[model samples]
Target chain A: MNVMYFAWVRERIGVPQETVETEAATVNDLIAELKTREDRYAAAFADISALRVALDQELSDFDAPLAGVREVAFFPPMTGG
Target chain B: MQVRVQSEPFDAGAELNGFAQGRTDIGAVVSFTGVVRDTDGTLQEMLIEHYPGMTTSAITKIVEEAVSRWTLADALVIHRHGPLKPGEPIMMVATAAAHRAAAFAAADFLMDYLKSRAPFWKKEITDQGADWVAAKDEDEDALNRW
Candidate 1:
């Protein structure tokens, strides 16, 4: 699976995208897995309320199932237009 | 319908003039352009970032909903990403319809949705420092009015 980050989250994570192999069942589960891997991930995921998730390019909830999902993106709330 | 996402600067008036061209059935055309404003006169640049794969699809869906809700002859959306000066344009929305009401309403709806729903982020660079612009509750609340 490919995981991505954007904006300040990307700056914190230090990478835009990465391919990860995981057994996570949901977006939150994946975040938990990543948090254990590095301090940067822990810091970025510290406040989930300040972040938003997208499963396969569509806006989705943290509890959204990751079954058959190829891409997951994490970022802060959009300030577009 | 046309949707363009680019970092290059664009002329909004030219884009508006070229939109829905030579269409006899269209009686009204409405457009809205978003410009970076330096409220405190201390801003240097605005940096915009967006998701690559999702942007086109998200915007297409928004415009399609507008087309279905209103009788539009055509529509155009252009959004830019990357660092931009305070006076530069951030984005533009244009809609053409048989009636003024439909065109006006559709354009307004497009702006409201684009403000909150698009997968784009903004950072303001001022004389003091650069900071990410937080999404406003008012932007989210604006969508409810549609």
Candidate 2:
């Protein structure tokens, strides 16, 4: 699966994009897997409270299932304007 | 018809006029322009940075979502990404609809979503140093109030 980050989320995560192979079934499960990666990933996932998740470009909740999803994006609440 | 994430400043009047070109069905056009403000009660420059492709795609999604929820005839969003002086145009959103209500609502919704949901990050250059503008709780609350 491909994961993307934006804004300050990308700054903290160090990389803009990454490909991960996981057995996670839900967005929450994916976060759990990411948190186990390293300190940076843990710090990024440490505060999911301020984060928003989008599955395949559509906004979704953290608990949303990721089954069959090809992409997952995590970022801070948007600040575009 | 156009969505841009660029470093150069844009003219809202020209852009809006261009968007409304040759369209008689658009009875009402609503637009919102965001400008750079001098934060910290001091006159300082603002630097806006964004991921090029990601920023454009994210803003396009927000505009599309607004169109999905409103009866808009046309829409345009142009956001500038780079260093900007105070009072310079930072972003612009224009929406056209047969009725003023739909145009106004859709334009406002697009701005609200863009402010809270876009990939652009701002850094305030102050006398002290450059500091990335942290996401504010009030900004998020503004979205939740919708």
Candidate 3:
């Protein structure tokens, strides 16, 4: 799966996107998996409440299933206009 | 309906003039332009970042819904990404209908959705430092009115 980060999440994680081979069943599981890899990941995922997730380019919830999902994006709330 | 997500600047006047031009059936046209605002005057530029694959699709879906819900003759949304200086046009939405109510309501709805639902983020670069603009509760609350 391809994992992407945007805004402050991208800055905190120090990279925009990456391909991760994981057996996680949901977005939350994937975040848990990423947090163990590095301190940056832990810091970025520190507060799930402040984050938003997108599954395959659609706005989704953190508990969304990852089955058949190709991309998962994490970012702060959108501030567009 | 048309949704354009681009990096380059656009001519809002020309686009507005061209939209629904010479359409006798459409009597009302409502357009709204969002500009990069420097409220406290400590800003340098606003850097807009977006999800390339999702930006157009998300906005198109919103526009489609607006059209379906109203008697719209045409609708257009143009949003820019990348660095934009203060006073520059950031985005615009135009809606045309046979009556003023539909056009006005749809344009207002589009702006509300664009502010919160679009997959775009704004970062303000100020004289002191750069920071990501936080999404305001009022902006999210605005969606409930629709």
Candidate 4:
């Protein structure tokens, strides 16, 4: 699976993207797994409410099942236009 | 419909002139262009970041909705990313319809969705420092009008 970050989340995580092999079933579970890897991931995932998630490039919920998901993205609320 | 996500600056006037050109079926065309604001005059540059694949797809969905609801003949959306200076055009939305109301309403609707739905983030680089532009609550609320 490919995991991605953007904006301040990317800055906090210190990387834009990575390939992860996980047994997680949901977006939240993936975050929990990444949080245990380093302090940076922990800091980035500290405030889940301040973040938004996208599964396979579409906006999705953190509790969304990741059964066939290939990509996951996390970022702050968009400030486009 | 046409959607472009690029870092290159575009001439909004030229784009508007070319949109829905030579189309006898279209009677009205409306456009809105967003420009970078240097409110305090301390800004150095505005850096825009976007999710490459999602940005285009999200905006395309918004345009599709606008077209379906408004009876539009054509629509165009162009958004810029990367570093930009104050007063530079950030994005533009144009819609063509058989009537003025449809054209106007669709353009407005596109702006509203693009403000909060598209996966783009902006960072303001000022003389003092850099800060991410937070999404306003009103932007999210704007979608409720639809």
TM-score of chain B taken alone, every candidate: 0.98, 0.91, 0.98, 0.99
Rate residue A42 of model 1 by lDDT: 98
Estimate the lDDT of model 3.
0.95
Which CAPRI category fits model 1?
A: high
Q: Candidate 2's residue-wise lDDT over B1-146, tens digit each?
A: 56888888888888977887898887898989998887666647888876554677788887888777886778899898878988899999999888899998888788778887777778788778777777788877777756
Compute each candidate's TM-score over C-alphas.
0.97, 0.80, 0.98, 0.98
TM-score, first chain, each model: 0.98, 0.95, 0.98, 0.98
The pairs that clash in candidate 2 are A78-B116, A78-B117, A81-B115
Q: Which candidate model has the greater lDDT, 2 or 3?
A: 3
Query: Model 3 over residues A19-48: C-alpha lDDT tens digits?
Result: 999999999999999999999999999999
TM-score of model 2 relative to the true fold? 0.80
Scanning candidate 4 chain B in windows of ten residues, the lowest lDDT window is: B18-27
All models, RMSD in angstroms: 1.0, 3.0, 0.8, 0.7
Scored against the true structure, residue A43 in model 1 reaches a CA lDDT of: 94
By summed lDDT, the worst window of 10 consecutive residues in model 3 chain B runs over B49-58
Model 1: per-residue Cα lDDT over B68-119, one tens digit each = 9997999999999999998899999999999999999999999999988889
User: What TM-score does model 3 achieve against the real structure?
Assistant: 0.98
